[model samples]
Target chain A: MTLASPLAALGRPVLAALAALGRVAIYAGQTFGALFSKPFYTREFLSSLLHVGWLSLPVVGLTAIFTGGALALQIYAGGQRFSAEAVVPQIVAIGMVRELGPVLVGLMIAARVTSSIAAEIATMKVTEQIDALVTLSTNPLKYLTLPRVLAGTLTVPLLVAVGDIIGIMGGFLVATGQLGFNKATYIQNTLDFLEGADVVSSLVKGAVFGFIATLIGCYHGMASGRGAMGVGGATKTAVAAASVLILAANFLLTSVMFGS
Target chain B: MIELANVTKSFGSNHVLRGVNLIVPKGQSMVVIGGSGTGKSVLLKCVLGLVRPDQGLITLDGQDVAKAEREAFLARFGMLFQGGALFDSLKVWENVAFRLLRGPLKRPKAEARAIAIEKLRRVGLVPETADLFPAELSGGMQKRVGLARAIAAEPEIIFFDEPTTGLDPIMAGVINDLIREIVSEMGATAITITHDMTSVRAIADRVAMLHGGVIRWTGPVKEMDVTSDPYVQQFIHGRATGPIAAVR
Candidate 1:
């Protein structure tokens, strides 16, 4: 085999990936430009808010509550190794607000909202509804993508805020009812341990992660191939990409906010 | 009038269209006949500016289509997809009234609904059908809804892409007759792409046969039967052997 063959093989996928990224950037720019234009489609925007925000509450609440309970138990156990059991309330507050709250909400949205948006749009594309929109003098980006993206961007942070509160409440309930800690002391420790910066960073992460998830969903759906398999593949890729990007964005935002 | 001169398009190694030339005069129906994957749909999409030609001139009434204002350019045309491209999220009336409810054509909600119901009636659908989703309808009913939606804005030009596909013969004939009647009534310039000779005879004032990425033959529909062009003859007669292959 030629020495250049391996290098060429490696370069091919790298180039393809770069091209895909370029397409995604262009798509994002177009959606952003279309965001402020006239013909706002307010009905679609409200519907999207209901879909991406209101409907997502149940799953978000359940996930947050369970994670918080487990997290409190884990922190209690870990603190025992250092004879630092008293730190449970403080650590759970910081952990849920600064990390678990936003990340878990983001991932849940990736699984729930991202996959749903991708599948629905991809099916519309395969069935020519997008083309129909174009023929009707409607820009699909404005009619479809912008509303969902805006909903995700605006609502995910609120969802995360809710998650953080619920998560802290779950920890408080566990620490008081099960761990023999007084309720009032637990609440005070959690409140005093959480700073405005930590809460702000968590919400910021939520917004960024929301944008990534919905945008990825729309992009994949718009670029999907033809038929059922294409819709399936788009859903799979959107969820996977959104999840990874949310985690990566979380890390980057964390470093920026807390780095030395 | 709409005209395409020396149009060409390719996707990867597939040269779907090469140097196609044709014209459709205003107020006449033109049916383009070709087998599956012979680029009939691509050619229709080209005229709608949904697909750009690699090299060609497409003009609508002496203005270059490529340079026309997109909203205005698309405003003049309506299309019925092979599959009824109705928005599943919307009711039948909402799908029909989609163009009226937004953009420059915006109408009051009640007026749009009234127009939608009228258009639905024009296509022989019951007023009750207006409140239902497309999924609730049968295949034939969905096609009628698509037809109603296509003509909702009363566009100057209309396109039918395989309008008779995926229907029983009776339903197919019903759709063809409805299309013919609608085109005549609206006096809208119409272009249809299909392999069904029945549809061609029923709908076309003029006919063009596309094969091998080009227009092999075109003439008035009455002359199509007598045309000796091998490809046209083979296609019209549904022959097994001809200049066109049975397999790609």
Candidate 2:
């Protein structure tokens, strides 16, 4: 192909991507705009809390423990080269509280929560249920989206807090049992080394990532194109968009939280 | 009464509605007959505010539909979607009494259930059917349930989108008869979009033929076949050779 043709092909996709981003921004704005409106569906909000928060704990907990255990081992081995092996307890505590805990939980929520929300909404659209909602005098954004996004934003910080504690416990288990560190001393070291700012930043990251993951899911699902192919495409795009946005938000949040 | 004055809509370059104008008088059963993809569904959606028209005004009584308060306006009408569109998460009774159990029309659960069962009975469904989910029912049963839901609130207006689709001939006839009887019984203004000639004769007082994104001919159902308009005649007779092309 000629250079001009290649450049045009690249330009086309970039323009398409920019247009999609603009659409997503509008969808997100509409979703948030509905938040302060009257006739709030409290029943729907409680239901969303159970689905997006309570049902998600098992997967998040499992991922956290495994990650914490593996992180402790890696840190222990890597620090041995510098004859800094004893720093394992402090390093694992700081790492779990400040970074790995929230990031992993956010990713897991992106995988489990985002994909499901997108598929359900997209299927509803394909089946004309959204139109049915309109005909029923219920706003789809209020009835379907706002509750889930609110639930995600509110509960995920708690999930991250739980994840951080579980991860630190996992690290403590490995360090005390496998690494032959004193159990009491390891716990003491962890408590002493972790700062209040670390935990605060971790929870803040959780809330931001939660909002990003859920809003993207809601946007993709509601804006899904027509038919079966469209629903499948929407579900795929929701997960992809949510996962990318979570990571990007994690970076920005980290920079703002500690970069200064 | 509902009036459409030069309403138009287009998606990208594909123009779906083009300056179409029609009126449905109060308490009249108006059937819109058209081939698939002729914007029959789009027209109904436009009036319901599900799709925004690109131009012109749609008014109910004397006020513009789009400018009216949304929930109050929607409360005056009910729609039977082409696919039934029942909330799969809800049981049959819950789906039927959806309005009664929520929003401004909230009622006691027991009362709502009783009303749902009563409405189900009106549509020839058993009270036990109210407890079952929509997925457990056959297509004909689902259609009947959808009908029951539409009439449950005693809406002043009802729109039926392909009410007879995907059913056997006998079931289709049953649904058509029920739609006609219910519309008259409630003294409700009704609009139905269908291509089924049987449905047209059974449900409509007047029939309007939609073709090429515009109303080709509109008159009493008796005059539909006898109209001099080639497009309406060709459509009613299902002719292979006519001014209306077989392909888009």
Candidate 3:
């Protein structure tokens, strides 16, 4: 192969990546534009809120409780090596609120909500339901994408707040009941250790992650090819992309808020 | 009248419609016939503005369809998709009255439901079917519901894409008869795209045969059987050997 040929091959992928990014950016702009227009689908929005927020509670609760218990155990074990065993309550509180709670909840939503949105929309496309909506004089962006994205963005922070409390409670239970600590003292220390910034950062991250997850789901779905393979591939890509973006956003937010 | 002049469309290197020209006059049922992948559906989609042409003009009542106000332009037309295209998340009545429940035709819930039930009854569905989701209905029932939805808004123009596909022959006959009755009773301009000759005989006022990216033959349905055109004969007769090849 010629030198120019290899160079062209490398440049082709970069160009394709840029084109995909541009398409997503344009889709996002159109979605936001539709938000201000008439024909807002109130019923769809309320249904989406139920799916993205209220319906997700049990899964979020279970994940948070289990994670918080395990985190306390690990911190206690690690602390004993440095004569820092007594610091378990404080570290667990900070870790759950500042990092694990938001990140885990974001990942779960990606797995659950993002995949679901992608699959449903892709199926609609394959069946020509989106075109049906157009023929009905209803914009698909307004009726389908906007409500779900808005619900995710507005409700995830609430879920994150709820998750943080449940996770702290899990840690508190483990510390007080199984680790030979006074229940009242553990509760007081945990509450005293967390700052307002930690909670704020957690919620902010939750909102951003939610936006990325739902937007990626809608984008990949609308762009899906044809047939069963198309639906499967879109769901896989949506979940993967949402999860990675959430993690990357978490790192950036963490550094911005706490880096020295 | 809806008119297409030199309409052409292509996807990548595969040219679908090339210099397609046809006129569907007001208040007539025009059936377009062609083999699979002959761009019959694409022609319908182009008129609906669901698919834009690579080149050419489509006009409705002498106004360019591409430039018409979107909602108002769409409001004048309704379509029944090949797969029924019913929204699975919606109940049957809600699917029928989709346009009435929202957008420019917004109606109160009770009024919309009443209209939906009326439309459903028009298509021979019981009132109880109105409350059931699309998935709960059989394929034939789904198609009837789709027909109800298409006529729900009382549009002046209606397009049916493969209206009888994926149904038992008896059910297909029922759907074909329903389409014929509805189009005539409404006095609406109707365009139907299908390869099924039975559907063509049962539905068309005029028949047009699409072949090799163009209109090969078009005339009154009564004259279709006697047409000397080879493509029209081969397609209508389901011949394996003709001017058109059987295999891609």
Best by TM-score: 1
State the C-alpha lDDT per candidate: 0.94, 0.91, 0.93
For the second chain, the TM-scores of the candidates in order are: 0.99, 0.99, 0.99
Model 3 per-residue lDDT tens digits across residues B78-147: 8999999999999999999999998879999999999999999999999999999999999999999999
Worst 10 residues of 2 chain B by lDDT: B218-227
Stretch of 10 with least lDDT, candidate 3 chain B: B229-238
- Evaluation by DockQ, superior candidate among 1 and 3: 3
On lDDT, the stronger of 1 and 3 is 1
lDDT of 1 by residue, A1-260 (tens): 69999999999999998898899889989999997788798999999999999999999999999889888899999999999989999989899999999999999999999999999999999999999999999999999999999999999999999999999888888888899999989988888888999999989999998899899999999888999999999999999989988998999998999976
Residue-wise C-alpha lDDT for candidate 2, range B83-174, written one tens digit per residue:
89998988999999999988888899999999999999999999999999999999999999999988888999999999999999999999
- Give the range where candidate 3 chain A is weakest over 10 consecutive residues by summed lDDT: A172-181
| Model 3: per-residue Cα lDDT at residue A189 | 89
In angstroms, how far off is A105's CA in candidate 3? 0.6
Candidate 1, what DockQ? 0.92
Model 1, which residues run further than 4 Å from truth? none
The root-mean-square deviation over C-alpha atoms between each candidate and the true structure, in angstroms, is: 0.9, 1.7, 1.2
Error of 2 at A250 (Å): 0.5
How displaced is residue A75 in candidate 3, in Å?
0.6
Q: Give iRMSD, candidate 2.
A: 0.6
TM-score of each: 0.99, 0.96, 0.98
